[model samples]
Target chain A: MSAVDTRVPQPTTPTPPSPRRMGPDARRVTARTVRYTLLFLFLVFVLIPVYVLLVTSFKPGTEATLTGAWDLPQNWTLDAWREAWDALSPSLWRSFAIAIPASIVSAILGSMNGFVFSRWRFPGSDIVFTLFLFGMFIPYQAVMIPLRQLTSDLGLASGVPTLIVVHIAYGIPICSLIFRGYYSTTIPNELVEAGRVDGAGLIRTYALIVLPLSAPGFVVTLIWQFTSVWNDFLFAIFLSNTRNGPVTIALNALAGGQLTDYAASMAGALIASFPTLIVYIVLGRWFIGGLMAGSLKT
Target chain B: MRSRIRNWGPGLLMVAPSIVVIAVFVYVLIGATVNESLTDRHTAAPAENYVGLENYANLLDDDRFIHSLKNLAVLTVVFVTGTLVLGVLWAFLLEKGVKGEGFFRSAYLFPMAVSFVASGVVWRWLLNSAEGEGAGGLNALFGMAGLDVLQNPWWSHPDWGMAAMAVPAIWQLSGYVMALFLAGFRGIPNELREAARVDGASEAQLYRHVLFPQLSPVALTALIIIGHMSMKMFDLIMAVSGAQYLTEVPAVYMWQALLTNDYAKAAAIAIVLLVVVAVLVVPYLIHNARTERQR
Candidate 1:
C-alpha cells in the first residue's frame, strides 16, 4: 500500500563502497554512464512527438510542412495559436462546462457513497461495491446504443448537459472507488465510531467529520474525473456535434478534416490538451495517486 | 432485526444514487442492448421484431467483422506487450536511481495527460509513409540517421497497420505501466533483496530470481488494464485511421453501423464487446473482492 504513494523517489543513504564483490571505481562509473545514457535515449524517444508538436505549432504555415516537422520554426508566429483558439475556444469552454460540474457532482456523490460503503457498511456491501467496481471496467460501446437512445428519449441529446449527465452516470464507479479506498484507508473507524458516539449519523458524520478530511480524496477524484471528461471523445462525438461538442470533438474536426492546416491542427491538439496537461502538471502527485487508487484496489 | 434495519436504512439511502446510476446505465442498459441485439431493429424506425440469433449469425460470416477481430488481436497483443516491456524497463531504470528522476518520470508521463484524439493527430503526421525526399516525421529522422531500412509505411502498412497503431498506444500508456511497476518495486521489502545479495546473487540474478517474480501481480494488473483498454480502443483508431478497414476494430465497426442506423447489428457488436470484456474483467474483480475481504 505504501508503494502506492509513488511520488518522487526519495534519495536514499548511499551504501559504503565495497570494491571486492562489486567492481572497482571505473567499472561502476561506466555502468552509471550506461544507465544514464539509456535513460537519455528513452527520454529522447518519448519526447520526439512532443518536439514535433511544439515546433510545428510555433511555425508559420509555410514552414510547418511535415518534411520539416523536426525543424525549429523559421518564422515563429502566433497565427496558428490564434487560428486554433478561434476554432476551438467555444468547444473548450463547453468542455469546462461539462467537466467542472460533472467532476464536482460525481465527487460529491462519490464521497457519500464512499463514506457509506467504507465505514457504514450494511450486509452485502462488499458485493454491492464489487458490482459498482465492475461498472468501471465496462466497454462504453456496449452501453452506447442504449445510452444514446435513453438520452434522446429524455430530450437530452446533442448538448453539454447530456454529456455531463452521461459522464456523471459513468463516473460513479471510479470516483466512488477512489473515495471509498481513500476513506477506508485514511479515515479510521475510530473517527466514525467517535462521531457515532457523539450522536453523529451517516449524513452528519460525513458532513461534519468525514467531509473535512476528504480534501485529498476530493482532489484525486476531481482531477481524475475532470481529466477523463475533458479528454472524452467517444461520448462527445456521440452525444454532441460540431455545434456544441467538447474540445476533443472540435480538435478532431480541426485535425481530421481534409484541409490540413498543419500548424493550426498542431496548435489545436496542444490547445485541446492544455487543461488536462495543466491539471497533470500542477496536481501531478495526486493525479498519479488517483490513477493508481482507481485501478489497484489494495 | 428492527435495529439492524434502522442501522442499514441510512447507509442504503446514502449509496442509493450510485446503485441506481450503475443499475440503469450499466446493468440495465447492457440488458437492453442484449435485448436489442436479439431483435430486428435495423433502421431508426420504431418497428422491431424478434430475430433471435440472426445478427450474431450474420457476424459469423461477416468478413469485415472477422478482419476487425484480427486487427483487434494484433493491436491488443502488440500494445499490451510493448507497454509492459517498456514500462518495466523504464521502471527498473528509475528504480536504479537515475539523475533527475523526477523530470524523467514526468516527461514520460505527460503524454497520459494528452487525449488520444490530440496525440493521434500528431502521430498520424509522425507515421506518414512517404519515402525519399517526401519522407517526413519519423521517416525523415530515420533517413537523417541513415536508417533508411527502418523507414517504412507505419500505420498505412497493409499487413501490420494495426501493429503500427499500437506504437502510439504504447507511447501513451507505457508511462502508466512504468508508474505501476515503480510502485510494485517500491512495495517489495528491502530485506528480501539484501538476503538475496548475501547469498551471492549477481545483480542480474537478483532481478531475475528475486525481483521479477514478486512483480507478477503488478504485471497482471497492467496486462488486464492494457488489455481492456486495447479492447475498447475507438477514439485513437478513429482519429488516426479514419475508419480505414486496415486498422478498423469492433468498436469502430459498431460506430460505423450506428451511423447507418443499423441498430441491431450495432447492438450485436456491442454485446460481443461487452461479453469479451466481461470474460476478461469479471474474474479479476471477483478475485480482487475475495482478496480484499481476506485482508
Candidate 2:
C-alpha cells in the first residue's frame, strides 16, 4: 500500500495528516495510535531477551524456575549473580587486562600508520595501506592453525601478550583506515607544511602537530578496538587455556553445561557484558559512528 | 640524496612495525596455511610435502564438511533475510519519527554491544526445548498463554534446528544492519522527498522508485557484512548449541579438526572459509578503493 495515499492530501512536514481524510482530528488519532503501537511492539521485541537475562539473574534459581519467564521475581535474590561473579570475575579481570593494553597499543600504532598514509604519503603507501586493508577480511579461521603453530613455537601459546599482539596485528587495518580518514579531513597539509617550514623533522612534526590534533580519532579507534578485542571469543578460545582465558570463554563455559543453570548463566552473561555495554551506553553515538566509518567508506 | 633518504626514513619507520606485523601475521600466515592445506597431515605431525590439491579433493568426499557447507548455506539465507527485513523495517519506522526516538534507537542498538556469547546464553535459556513443567522462556510464555500446542523443539528439533540458530544471529546483528540503514535514510535530503511529492508520487512509489535505488549501496554493504559474519560464525553456535554437527558451520568444523590435529583437513576448511569470505568482501574492498581513488 502507498504510505501516502494519492486520494488523501499529505502534510508538508513528516507530522502525518491527510486533509482529504474524514477529519484532521481522526487522522491524527489514527496516526498516533498506529505509531505508538508499532514502537511499543518493537521496543518489547528488542528488550525481551535483555529483560529475561536481568530478571532471571536477579531471581533465585528456584524462583526463576517457579515463576513465569516474564514475571518479576517475588523474592529477588542476588545469589545467582554473586555466584556467577565469583566464578567469572577472574576471567573478567583477565579480559580487562588483555583488552585495554591491546586497544591502546593498536590505536597508537594505527595513528602513526594513519599519519604516514594520509599526511606523509610516500611512494607505494597506497599499496601498503591496501595490503593492510585485506587483513581486515582474511577470516581468522584461515590464519589460526599457522598462527597457533607460530605462537607455540615462539613460546607464546596461551600467553595474554600473544593475544594482545594478535589483536593489534588484526586491529591495524580498520584503525588505520579510520584514523587516515579522520586526519585526511581534519588536519590539512598546510599545517604539516607549516611545521616543516619551521625546520621540524618528520617525527617532530608528527609528535607536536599530528599527535596533539588526534584525540577524537584516537577515541573512535580505541572504542572500536577495545570492543572487538573484549568481545572476541574465537581467538580467545583457540589461543588461551582456561586459566588464562578471557571472560567470553569463561561465560561460554558457564553456560555450556548439561543441567542448564539458567539463572547463573544469565547472571554470568550480564556480568561479562558490562564493560562493552557501559562503553555503548556512555558513548553510543561515537560507537555507531565508528561502525559506519569502518564499513561505509564509500 | 642523503637528505632525501633521511626524509623518507621517518615515515617508513612510523609504519614499519605495522607493515612487519601484517606481513608476518596475515600474508606469511596465509601462505603457510595454503602450504599446510596442500600437504598430508593425517599423521601425528603434519607432512611438509605438496600433494597437489588432495585436501581440496578430499573435502569433496568428506560428508561432514559438505554437510557443514549445507548448514552454512541454510544459516546464510535465514540470517541474511531476517537481518535485512527486520533492519530495513526498523529503519523505516524510525525514519517516520517517533517520540523518544533516541531511547528507541539506543534500545535497538544495545543488543549489538552485548557479545554473541552473552546473547547465546540468554537465547539458549529462552529457546530451551524442554516440554511441560520443565519448559522455560518462550516455551513457558506459550504454555502460560494456554498455547501448549504452539511450543516446538526450538534448537533441539533435528530438522529445523539449524533455522532456529538464526534467532540468536538475527538478534545480535540485525541492530547493526538497522544502524547502517538508518544512516543511509538520514543521508537522503528532504528536498528529494519534497520533489517526489510535488511530482504527484505516492510515498510508496517514491520509496520504491527513488529512495531504494539510493540505498542500494548501503543494502549491498549490509549484505556483505552479514554474509561474512554468518559464514564464519563460531562463538554463537558454540555457546548456544555446542558443536551439534547438525548446526556445525565451517568455522566450528575447522576448530574441531584443529583440536584433533587434523592439520590438513583443518587447513582445507580454513582455506575454503577464506575464499568464501574473500568472495563476499573483495568486491566491496575493490569498489571502496576505486571510489577513494576517484575522490
The digit string of per-residue lDDT tens for model 1 on B167-279 reads: 99999999999999988888899888888888999888989999999999899899899999999999999888788788889999999999999999999999898888889
**lDDT (10s digit) by residue, model 1, range A42-65:** 999899888899999999989988
Q: Which candidate leads the pack in lDDT?
A: 1
Off by over 4 Å in 1: A1-22, A197-199
Cα misplacement distance, residue A119 of candidate 2 (Å): 2.4
Candidate 2 lDDT, A90-112, residue by residue in tens: 99888998999999998999899
Candidates' lDDT values, in order? 0.89, 0.85
Candidate 2, residues B1-295: lDDT per residue as tens digits? 8877666678888899899999999999999999889898865574968897999998989998988998888888999999999899888877766667779888888888888999998887778888788788788888988999988888787667778888888877888888899889878887888889999997689899889899998999899889888888898899888887877889999989888888988999999999988987888887877787788
Best by DockQ: 1
TM-score of 2: 0.92
Error of 2 at A45 (Å): 1.3
